[model samples]
Target: MPLPTQEKAAGMTTRGGSTSKPEKRQSGCGGEVKDRRTVEDRLDELLSSMLTRDYLDRQIKQLKMDIHAENKEITERLEGRIYELETDNEDLRKTVGSLEKEIESLHAARDKTEIKLNDLEQHGRKDSLRIIGLEDKSENESVEECVEKIVRFVTDKLEVSLNKNDINIAHRLGNFTRTKPRNIIVKFTSRRKKHDIIRARKKLRGSGQVIFEDLTRNNQQILKDAFRLKCVKNTYSIDGKLFAVLTNGKKRRLFMDTPLSEEYLMNDGNFRRL
Candidate 1:
């Protein structure tokens, strides 16, 4: 049966060898109707099959196109997200680096401060420094003493207008030697005055400060204390020479010692305040 069916299909070929069939008409009308019905059924089946196949192919192509479009959108979104994450990571790294640098600077400053503090503490005092009491010839330090000490120190001396506020009588030197100041510097708001300049001359009479003195006529030359007195209105030099004196009724005369040049003046600045 299969061979016969195959032969029938081969016989449908036309003279050009393409698949085609031709119909023959019978003399009877009924026989012709039956043959025509069979041909119509075959044609219907071929047309239905072609239509179904076309519809299925078009649906598959549409499904493939939709999948491709969705995949493209997803890939673009992921790429954008990755770019944002990379930028954020870079910013965090920079911030961390800056913080580390600041911490290092603070540590360096702290180390320098510690070294300076140690140096200062090392030079504060010596082991030989000690505290001791002073008597008649006190040590070189100011200390409290009784009124009897002040009275004994000023024996036979006519104390002038003694401003208690200005009087600073104190004992110094342990017992080896005692030094008393003669000339006193009196400071006022408007002017300055030197007191006991003559007194210092009296005190220096037996000391090394005076060169000569005549006790009978009270004619004498006195050494003014440069450490405690200023020769603003007086005419005296460090050489113990009094050039000009304030006469009772005459104007005081001043003579300028030869002026020293700026370079020759010994500008080591150690004796600048002196």
Candidate 2:
């Protein structure tokens, strides 16, 4: 079964003695080495790409954390400032409330003091009298001269017994003016003597002479305001208590704080009707 040399070169014989073509064979191992180099190069490229992508992902995650931290810090700072402002505003409101209460207390205290002072002033003037339409010829008149004039006038014109000793002090109220004669203020040693003179004031009513009780400035203004009303026929004060005689023959007791209005003055219930 040995084949000829030409046929052996063209084909091969198997165990069954059948003719078959031979598999092709490479001349060297260069092709296999080249294919292995190509596979290593592709793996190197894929690993480098994966590493770069991982680095970028880490950088992005860190940047997001940084931004979140910065925003949290800013929000905390703003919230703290708002809380401080709210606390300050509440404190200011409390301070204003305290100030308003203090002001009201001060006003009440002042009103009480004014009332006490007015009462004291009226008490001091209980024995004093004001003589209007009295003649004052000289500005250099002495207090004793004024006292003598008051005594003579009370004795002669008023028909009342008055002595120089009964009058404690007498003086003109203001500077001498050529336009009119100033009134004289006389203080008596006793209220009895002042009352006696006042009781006799009506005798000189037609003689162009008048006498009035010494009143506080506030009471005086109240009397003046009462006189200005047409409904008030006559106004007078006895012991610093003011009285208004209305046109209907009724008398109304008035006070320093009474309203000087027609409606208030004309109220019938307030008057002692004739």
lDDT of 1 by residue, 114-218 (tens): 645533432231111111221244343333333243333333232423232333332322234446422211121211111332333354344333312111110
Sequence-dependent TM-score of model 1:
0.27
lDDT of each: 0.39, 0.86
TM-score per prediction, in order, is 0.27, 0.64
Residue-level error in angstroms, candidate 2, position 137 = 0.7
Best candidate per lDDT, number?
Answer: 2
Clashing residue pairs in candidate 1, if any? Answer: 138-172, 138-173, 138-174, 139-173, 139-174
Query: Which pairs clash in model 2?
Result: none
Ten consecutive residues with minimal summed lDDT in candidate 1?
211-220
Q: Residue-pair clashes per candidate, as listed? A: 5, 0
